[model samples]
Target: MDILMGEPEQSLEKEIEADLTIGDLTVHEDRNEVMHFLHPVVYMTNIKGLYKKDDVLETKWTSYITIFRSNVYLSIFGVSVLVSILFVVIARSANRLHRGLDESALVVWLDASWFTLAALAKQGVDYHSQGLSGRFIVVSWWIFAIIMSTAYGANLISQLSVHKEQKPFHNLAELIRSEDYSFGLIEPSITSMIFQNTKSGSVKQAWSVLRERAKTNPEVLDANPANHFKMVDSGKYCYLGSNYYLEAYQGKDCTLKMMDSPVSWQHLAFGMPKGSPLIDEFERTLFILNQIGFVADRRKKWFKTRDPEECRSSASVKPVNFADIQIAFYLLATGTLFSIMSLLSEIVIASTKKR
Candidate 1:
């Protein structure tokens, strides 16, 4: 089979009867449709995404400090404080019912705080409520503790275990909206023409930006076929082109990845003349080629080797390193030092008073 490359519209201009063609032929508004399927318009970005072979979808790793700042912990703290204050107030008001429990106001407050802390930690405390109001508060606190603990546990497990993919852009829509990477298509290309004349709002928006960039920096809008892949490799630009070309360009570079979704869908099929007798035979052969792994073999030959081990599942439980909690330990040390100094000062003052 002889392979010829020409624009789909050119098929109408040139009256050569052919059996098949290879390219994504777009259907114009006049109901003219291209009859073969090959590849789609895939967006490219230099942003790397992390993924595990076991995971169906990729996710991003979040910092522990970020997890601590979540709404769940904030709600737990707020509710615990309110409940603690109520317990203290009720304990003092019904003081006669509880005999020889606590002597000072500070002791009562300390007990109240400790009670909430123990409940929040899901640990059982030795102390029990003496009065009816105190018992009701205790029961309510336990219920709150149970719900909050379960939720926090589930959230924490998901946060720490799930593998996250870190990519610059997730979809075509995001690529257009993002300011991090500059993107465009080659001039006089079919892709550029599609965006230039599209009625879709997003396409128009992207085209406007490209047009502006072209006015200032024409290099950004250059249509050189080779420059698209080169710019992507340099990590400064995002190139919009056929996934077929992109796949070839990727070769052995693991650093490059196509966007998960594409901006548009294109059909690739063998070009044939109108009412060609071999159209049915060619279509069947195409399907057979795909089923027999011919397409897979070709792809493997051109692209990088797909290795499961490269992005395999990792340990869910990460050991807490010193850097993870250094801030917390520093604060604790500061507090302990201040308390020791305060105790020493109090002892010295008492000695002076006695003298």
Candidate 2:
């Protein structure tokens, strides 16, 4: 058997049709009409998006608060304020009935607010409610605090333990919708052909976008797959291609990632002349190899990394660094600075009164 390097212009299907060479090509309905394909060598393989890892946004300092929805934060805030107001009303009424409590209304309000906040933080306050109504409200607030704090703690730990990275686009539709990314696949390839021929959907829309872009920038529909990969490495482009090819490229460049969602699924098989007699024989051989685990071994050897643990160490959980929770320290610093300013202001006011 002679091996020949296929070209974009002279595709493997054309060569096989001319009885020159049998080549492995993605089995498509159009190609199936002209060439005979052996039983699919690769099944359910898909086209995935490839992009640079640097393009993904890293976990921000505000991730602790941002992980919860806006509604959740609003609900917590609303409940805390409501509880503080209730506590203040009940405590003031009790103090009025029994003149032993000398705290002013403003002091009571501040203490109530602080108590509610401290309970939410799972901390204790020195002040306690004297009346039964006030004590009942305190117990209810404690229960609410326990539930909210437990949920917050669980969610925060789960989110922070895994370093969150947000990709620019999750799937092809998002990639198409995004104005920031320019995506292209190799021209004359099965994936590009599918995108071009599809009737209506994101695939067709993507093709239209590429076609329009190609009118000005010819690289948008280039025949060379290397150009697409190079564009992807620059962090401004996305490349849509076969999963197998993308995975092979990813193995070489750790910075490159294949999106989990696939764009399309296609069967991969060897192409032969329309009336090829070896299809049956090849199918039998493939079946036998599959049963003997030969095919599985070869696939693992080529497509998978030798040491997956080493390749994925960057994604694994490690001890939390200062950078992960620096927002808390920032809040503390801001509070201390405000307290110093308040003290200075009070000192100035007292000296002015004495003068």
Candidate 3:
């Protein structure tokens, strides 16, 4: 038989032991440990930044403008602009040799910009340069455009192929090692005691950190499993508790997940006062129950069937939203403003020279 109970705690195990010592009730020595349960496991959930939605786990979508934010992309863009400006300067200095054209500085810059853009697009310009230096610059820029275009194409293809899912922590050891996550046990519980007395180096370290957390923030020792579930959903928290309870609570919620690796194991037993006369009778009944397969049936009924809705819903791809592209819009606005200002400055200089 299985039952779940909760109460104001002073360590339930110690309370049971104290009752046995003081003769409040008697317990069976041979049948004391009723069953074995794997140690409490950790469950973590997050709604933002690396989470599952409608069953499928995925990374946040990349914004289109984000490509321009890359240092490499910006560097290439700056080089293209510089190369265009260099062409304009060369075109002016060598204008006498190709004397048929008469154009303003702004017109020269505009033409150079168009030529540079077309070259980057792998398009040929109709205009031909008379000077050897002009021809050399054009050839060099064409080679640069070829290499950059190839590199960018390869990088963009690689980015599109990969998924960016991020997990909060893979296991208990990882949870303990990370400073980003705050972890704690259901206080005054078997799992808490196990952590406090654990011989395992990783678990022991985790316990020490948890102890410090409790001292620093007394509320870190959460008494309620329900609160633990809430904390996990709220993000950046790892709740350690019995697998039985965790499975029961998270079985319905799609977002919550238990770590595959268990942190420890425990011997779960029913307790009574020492030297109780009914111990043999209880043991006999339990033996009969096990023999008839009642225990296994009960476990299969409650624990075996996990919710499949999460799995079923995970197939659909989530739609991309404005938050993903907000930064890109900001970058575009900044670039547009800067361009308008530059054009205005060029107009002012031209007008002053005419005056």
Q: Identify the leading candidate in terms of lDDT.
A: 2
Q: Which model scores highest in TM-score?
A: 2
Q: Which pairs of residues collide in model 2?
A: none
lDDT of 2 at 346: 46
Q: How far does residue 16 in candidate 2 sit from its true spot (Å)?
A: 7.2
Worst 10 residues of 2 by lDDT: 15-24
Model 3 vs. true fold: TM: 0.45
Off by over 4 Å in 3: 1-164, 302-305, 312-355
Candidate 1 segments whose C-alpha is farther than 4 A from its true place: 1-17, 23-65, 68-71, 78-106, 114-179, 275-355
TM-scores for all candidates: the values are 0.53, 0.64, 0.45
lDDT of each: 0.58, 0.69, 0.56
lDDT of 3 by residue, 1-355 (tens): 3222432132244443222221111122222353221111112221111112222334335633343346556655776787677667667655643464556778778888898788777788865554655665666666666655554455455445544445666777787777777877777656666667668898889878888888887655787767777777776777787666666666666666666577875434344333655556666665676668775565467444465665343223232334433443344335434544544454466568669
lDDT for each residue of candidate 1 in 202-244, tens digit (9 for 90 to 100): 7788889888988888866786967766667666477877666
Residue 212 lDDT, candidate 1, scale 0-100: 90
Q: Which ten residues in a row have the lowest lDDT in candidate 1?
A: 46-55
Better of 1 and 2 by lDDT: 2
* lDDT tens per residue, model 2, 175-200: 88888888888887888888877775
